[model samples]
Target: MRRLLLASCIALASLSGCASMGGASSSDIAAVLASPSRSADDRQRDARDKPAEVLALAKFKRGDTVADILAGGGYYSEILSGIVGPDGKVLLVNNPGYDAFGKKGYTERLANNRLPNVTHVVGPSDALGIGEGVLDGAVIVMSYHDLYWVDDKMGWPKVDAGRFLDQVVRALKPGGVLLVVDHSAKQGTGSAAAQDLHRIDEQFAIADFRRHGLQWEAAIPVLRNADDDRSKNVFDPAIRGKTDRFVHLYRKP
Candidate 1:
């Protein structure tokens, strides 16, 4: 039965104009946001997160298989599901630590198989359980810093950043897109801020992805907040939702 459903979904997706080149239009995104199935909480967050604008930078097409890596509570997963329609698939991936942290949220979002195209996968940081060259696109939103974080008590162990990235890079097909969005740290701080401030140095992130052989495609400044001094923790009450963030897009060669 499950296989039949997926096959039907793929057939429907193949018929969509979404498979054509270029990103989703503003109208298309707005329509997704306006979905009655979407939660009121997610709609409220759209004002601050600007999800429509961020997703536009990804240039995802219909029938595209995408992964929302370390997706906390499946916020972007739900949105991606709408954008991809019935043809594409959305992988809502979460490491063990993140799964524990966001169990309630994801459980609620995925209840009753509300998102048929989304598959929830929970695995370790080093092995995300996704196959090589299978993904057409992926996104890491605000959670990439977790790669550099280590908290034994919280169940987030020290991750092998290189190996972790290897899994992600290997999962993307040639020409597949990677979109990374994270809170920015001060210049030259590198991953230093990741552990304490929950932020990363923007330049360091670009260079890190480049080292993995993904071509730097574009940097969109839709979420930049200059007033953020890149000092406080992203969870700090003073700047929780107002931190400066960097949005970078990369592609497999």
Candidate 2:
């Protein structure tokens, strides 16, 4: 199955010149959604993730240079690769703090460097070092709140949120998009929930994004779970994957 995906990608590369013309098409989403090469594990998660819809909401397109911030184990990286086709590229980035958990699996996914157009970028949270105006879009999947996460024992750095936002802004080209999805924290709660509950207030997130000059484009409520109490830690077994989440899209001017 892996070979089939690889071969398909290789074949696509040969026809890539014409693939970028229309940006991402509905067919692109359909192909990725139906690909036989996708693993059962990924397929199982699909019911909960609704990736194709998420990608579509972000208006992700062919030939885009997109980044998956704190891309843990390349789940979205792999899907974006298939969606963007051979003409596009996906940059999977991990900061030092998050790398401990993600590095090994990410390396394994890229073993033999099979996904040619996908590149792994590692750096500190404060300084991403992405080339200015190089990226067309970026996504933070349930990870935007990590800007406030700190774990000394595990070597997680105390992230400076403002500096991190500055770096993200610098990485994007004008009109580039930024998509953020995260677990919802209680209303009126600030960064406290981010550290304790592994979540954030959606409004707080929007304020931060606006502060960094990203205009809020839209919000998707597909993942909302009204029953979620939003008080417990997100890792609690019962609400782990079912935690109500917010999907927000922003754009650079």
Best by lDDT: 1
> Candidate 1, residues 1-253: lDDT per residue as tens digits?
5664455345434433543556676555665776656678998989988887888888777778999999989999988887787778999999888898878889998888878889999888888897799999999999998899998988888999999898999999999999999999999999999999999999999999999889999987889999999889999999999999999999999
Give, for candidate 1, the lowest lDDT window spanning 10 residues: 7-16
Q: Could you give the C-alpha RMSD of every candidate to the true structure, in order shown?
A: 4.2, 2.5
Which clashing pairs does model 1 show? 13-87, 18-62
lDDT of 2 by residue, 117-156 (tens): 8998988888776778888899999888888888787687
Per-model TM-score, in order, reads 0.92, 0.91
Full-model lDDT, candidate 1? 0.86
- Which 10 consecutive positions of candidate 2 have the poorest summed lDDT? 10-19
lDDT of each: 0.86, 0.81
